[model samples]
Target: MSERPNYETMYILRPDIAEDEVETHTNKYRDLVIENGGTIIDNQQRGKRRLAYNIGKHREGVYVQLNYSGDGKQVGPLERAMRLSEDVIRYLTVKYEGQHSSLGRSTTPVAPMESSAPRQDRDLVGAAAAIPAASDDD
Candidate 1:
C-alpha cells in the first residue's frame, strides 16, 4: 500500500537570479521529492513581487508554491534545499490543517496564492466576525 500523505509545502525564491536559475532550483527539489517516492500535486510559480520587508538584502522575489502529498520525512530535505539554494532569499512552509485539501490536482490549475504581501482572506474573516449589532440609539 502507498504511504499516507502528510502536509503541503510552499516556498519563495529570490528574483535577482537569472530566470534559468529559477528553473534549476525548482527542478532540483522536485526531483528530490520524486526520488523520495512522493507525488507532486502542483508546482506553481507565483511570479515576482515586492517584499513587505527586506530579506537577505532583497526587495522582491520570485515566489513558488508546491502542493505535494508525501510522508512527513520529505519536509526536511525540502527545507534543506531551500537553505542551500543561493537564489532563494526567504521561504516558509506551512502544514495545511483539518480536512484540508491538497492544492490543485494535475487536471485543474488553481490561482496561485499571492506571495510577498499581506493576505486579504484573514483580515476579511476578522472584519466580518467583528461586526457590531444594531443598537436602539433613539
Candidate 2:
C-alpha cells in the first residue's frame, strides 16, 4: 500500500461573508476532506486581511488554511468546490514529502545581526580599492 502524502490548502473567501457563513464554509471543506478519505492535521482561520491587489472589485478577503494527509485523490473534489463557489476568491494546494516542511509548527523568526564596521571604511579597505575606475578612452 502507498503511504499517504501531506497537503496544505489555503483559500481566500469574500470579505463580505457573515461569521456564520464563514464557519459553514470551513466545515464544508473539512467534511469534504474527511469524506474523501483524508485525515485532517490542522485547520486555521487566519481572519480577514487586505489583499495585495483588488480581486473582483474587492480590496480584502478572508483566509482559511487546511493541512491534511491523503492519497492525493481528495484534492480534485475539494478544489472543484472552491472553483464553483462564489464565496471563494482564490485557492492553492501544496504537497509536502516529509517532516522537512514546518507545517503545524509555530516558530519565532530571529532577527539578522548587524555589522559593527562602518560601511564607508569597509568599502575602501580591500578589493574595492584595488578595482580600476572607468575611463572614457576607446
Candidate 3:
C-alpha cells in the first residue's frame, strides 16, 4: 500500500451563517475527510473576519483550517463536496512532502551561511595613479 501524504486545507465560509451551523459545517467536513480514507490531525475555526475585498457579495467570512493525511485519490471527493456547498465561499488544499507540527506553522530554524574568504582593503590612491586620464581635447 502507498503511504499517505500530509495535507492542509483552509476554507472560507459566509459570515452570515449561524454559530451552530458553523460547528455543523466543520464537523461535516471532518467526517467527510475520515470517510474518504483520510485521518484528521487537526481542525480550527478562526471565527469571522472582514475580508480585504467582497467575495460573492460577502464582506466578511469565517476561516476554517484542517490538517490531514491521505492518498491522492481521497482529495478529489472532499474538494468536490466543498465546491458544491453554497455556504463555502472558497477553499484550498495543499499537499506537503514531510510532516508538520501544526497547521500553517513551521518549527525548524534556518542555518546561517559561512564565507571562506576574508575581505581586504586596498589603496584607492595608488590604483588611480596607475590609470591615465583622457584629455578633454581627445
Residue range 1-138, candidate 1, lDDT tens digits? 964654556667877778888888779888887887778767777789888888877888888877667776777888898889777787776655333444332333467976998657988898888998779997
lDDT of 3 by residue, 1-138 (tens): 767788888999999899999999999999998998889888999889898999989999999998899886668888898999999999999987655675466445557988788754467767888889988995
List where candidate 1 sits over 4 angstroms from the true fold: 1-3, 97-138
Off by over 4 Å in 3: 1-3, 108-138
lDDT of each: 0.74, 0.89, 0.86
Ranking by lDDT: 2, 3, 1
* Tens-digit lDDT string for candidate 2 (1-138): 877888889999999999999999999999999999999988899999999999998899999999899988989999999999999999999987654234554343557999897667665677777998889997
Write down the TM-score of every candidate: 0.65, 0.72, 0.74
Model 3, residue pairs in steric clash: none
Which of candidates 2 and 3 is the stronger one according to TM-score? 3
Overlapping backbone residue pairs in candidate 2 total 0
Best by TM-score: 3
- Candidate that beats the other on lDDT, 1 or 2, i.e. the better one: 2
Scored against the true structure, residue 72 in model 2 reaches a CA lDDT of: 89
For model 2, the local distance difference test gives 0.89
